[model samples]
Target: MDIDLNTLRASIDAEVNRREFERLPARDDDSLPAAGLIDSVAAFEPIDLEGYLPEPPEEHQHIEPELVAELLPEGRFYNWLKRPPFARHLQRPRIYSLLTRASRLPGGARLSNFIYIMARGIAYRIPALARLLEQSKQWRYLPGRLAGFEYQANQGLYAHALAVQRNERYLLDRLQRLEQRLREQQAQAARTAGAPAAEAASPPAAMPADLYVDFEAHFRGSREEIRQRLAANIPRFKAVAALFSEPVLDLGCGRGEWLQLLQESGIAAVGVDSNPSMVQCCLDAGLQASVGDGLAYLQGLPDHSLAGLTAFHVIEHVPLDVLVRLIDEARRVVRPGGIVLFETPNPENLIVGACNFYTDPTHRNPLPPALVAFLLEARGFIRVEIERRHPADPKLLLQGQDDGLVQPLNRLLFGPQDYAAIGHAP
Candidate 1:
């Protein structure tokens, strides 16, 4: 690169200005010096305007690397002083710390202050340590500067949120009014056009068989696998099954696993589901099955008629208020001393609730085990028990450790993924 005479002069002036800044007297409160004042001229190393200066070759291009290293110069006096024996060490961290302490003391105070500033500037290069250093500087004003938002901004945000809510309500009200008006117009046209015309135009109320079956296939396991799992748990069902004179009623019986298990155990049972294909599959397998909404079926049954009522992984598909009503109906429809069992995905298992439970789009929300138990008791059902089911892998669970930490960790990581709320109707 070429060096211009004007640029060379400017660079020389900047070096002199930098030296003047270093000689400036220190302030009382430890503020920075006026070093930034020379920044304009500091941009030039040498005045290379005409490309007169040569650029160095790339690092690894030379065969004799040591010769290339020798080209860089170090002052003779400094090199002799920095050598071994007479030169043990020129600097250490402790020396800087002692210098900082001396800055607060009586004599040599100004020199110590300059050393302290230089040491801290070097320390700020490491990001992790630098953040802690920065926090120390901001300690007094942290509360006022939290998230850097002002009081005015918070108030404005609150007002904007309220306005958005009001606009949403207004739009909903207008939509409902428009729907009602459209319905009225349709009804008026039906009166003039005839009942047959209205019937022809009406849409189907039930979900298509192929679509419903496909949805079940996407979210559910095979019927054979479910039956095998249910068969393994037949001992638990038998205890409840033996207490009743009439057959059990299994509502929302997806693939008839419980129904098949009840038959194999010689316990009479009937199943009901909203899906026609599911009900047909159950009937084809010679199980007594019916197509109907679970809630409506429970309502239609005579009071205290069924021996036991069991619905697995079904309650979470309905609204909370509807679930509460279903519990009340279960207590009513079940005979005295009969079992009412409702199982659902447990919200207590962090993984089940936060992740796996949502794999099925039909699931509304996970039901807390305690909440279901409390609901059963509130609805005049006694001897209620919360039975956690389907625990995750044992290796994942923190176990066999005497420490208190492992127990909570075990409950969070390997606790039951699903739970059953069992109660006896009085």
Candidate 2:
């Protein structure tokens, strides 16, 4: 391998100039004193420049006159002692670079500054430490410098160790709790698994075939709550009334709130609810209502007989296939020019969608505005317009606070879930 002596000389000169030392002498060490160049020259020895400086093996080949002068020189003395070539000459510049880079030293300190600087420099510049030490060739000065660096670096190292220990303790505690829970769940699951098989072997409980068969049982308790809300909506039901001049069907109409409004507005309105309790309550209130399934009642209506239809918060609980069928039913009943004014809870309200939404065991899902609009439009309903009512309750502010950024971002990007769709059959 051939080493580029000219390039090696150029790099050595560059290193020396970086330390503000004089240019390389053309002659050898026989003439001048090599004072400041030792630190710079020694620093370059550890770097494997074989790829750059490939040369053949010979006694004269590896030896640079400048490097030789810097290393194995004859008699050179600085102050009170004689200086050997490779012994130790940590000139002021290397000392300054070490201390200033670590931001530890001030100007005009004693020569002992090199001791602290070397310790920290080694820690600060790890793999570079060996290279720098080889370049400085000042390893012969004090072996204690290595130990000092280990001590300095250990300060932060111990703090990290304590934090890791605390994290391990926390994880172990959580793991133990999880293991206990798994054991309990396994035992409980074994017991319940047996019970299900026993029940399956026994005579099965009779189930209601149609939803209307047991609808009254669920509504008996919530009858007053439904009736009160329905009664309150009596006057504000003008939206559906204004949509049609012909007959209208009100779906899931508990106690006929909109029917009363339609009657007062002088528009024909009919109420069909599956809950017998709710139907009786509507009759007691002197409003026209009947105990029957909404889908069946809507389907039974003569084609093109109705002018409008309105279903509020009722679509979400309806299955998707059932919903499409209901849309077909709505299309069948309403005349070509009539409108369907439908409302459902918006899924965009995070508290409602994520938490309160599931409280009603019967609710299938919250119907989003886009989904409702798309289904209605696809089923031959034209001129569909969506509107959002009922801002989320102030109680949901706590949940909404964390999801504030998320809610608006989704609304901007995907549109809202809880809204109303008013579409015509045109």
Candidate 3:
């Protein structure tokens, strides 16, 4: 070949410039380096020409020559058989329409249900076959689509299990606390047993020994008369009779009239009194009775030990502090929804408050109905109410007077001779 002198001279100059450019250091710009370029041109070594060639697109890339040679031809017939007919996208709509129409026919729903159950049973029985069937839908990526649904279901189950465990733990903790409190109360009672009788009889301390001596003989009425007066309260207790499944405690149970009445009504009752004579009378009448201070007896019992507590004409004998402690102990010892009833001379009635109240030397002071009711509420009792009882005879009222003062005078002179403060434990 013939060479042009001018072109040859230009090519020699370009070759000299290219070698100089290759020897220069790389630029410090953010742009990436060319493929196969080393950190520095000074350390670069020439690679094989084949290694520097551009790679073919992945879609058009060929397999290994030996592997391609071993692969047998996948004929039209084999491909057709390999693909599942039900899974074909083109036929799915037609198959679904046919199934809907068949299901509309009589008994078709039952037949379809039976088939679905059988299919599930077969899948469970042949897990390997089930896995193979699932693999056929790999193109649709069923597992990936169902992943979120499965995660949500598992979360719900976990939350429910956690809630149940927490509730069980809470209930167990409450039970343990109650048991501990009961043990503490028992220990306290044992300690108090060896103490002085005066300490134990805290409430009755307001009453002098002279008052307790022959007090029942001088003040207590006949059993028949007391029973007649107490009979009116039987119906009041009947409504909540079922709540007294456990024994009811009657504090200051004088003469055992209330105990006898409870026995007639088929309710189990126990009596506590500071007076040994009154307790003996209860025992002699086949009633369970104990000679102990009402407040101390209540303190000795465990939480929720009693179903009901009743003290008739007893609270008036105790001081305010003693009455408060008595009510507090009653609240602790009584069960939830249990009854607490206190009957005392009504201070609302002028005759009772000024005259009849002091007839009993043991009475500390007459408690107003409002004060008693308020105390019950303050101590966490519910449904507190004051029920006035033993109204004065109508004949005792000033007759033939249309004046408003007449009614007021009668109320102040007579009104209700006694009142009861009734409450229920929360």
- On residues 228-328, what C-alpha lDDT tens digit does candidate 1 reach at each position? 65675577668767776688998887667789889989998999887777778789888999977776677667778888988888888877766865776
- TM-score for every candidate vs. truth? 0.48, 0.42, 0.53
lDDT per residue for candidate 3 within 55-115, as digits (tens), equals 6644344434333213312334223422565234213333333333444445553445435
Candidate 3 worst ten-residue window by lDDT: 69-78
lDDT of 3: 0.72
Sequence-dependent TM-score of model 2: 0.42
Index of the highest-lDDT prediction: 3
> With candidate 2 superimposed using the best TM-score fit, by how many Å does residue 231's alpha carbon deviate from the native?
10
Off by over 4 Å in 1: 1-219, 395-407
- Each prediction's RMSD to truth: 28.4, 23.8, 19.8
| Residue 86 lDDT in candidate 1 | 27
As a TM-score, model 1 comes out at: 0.48
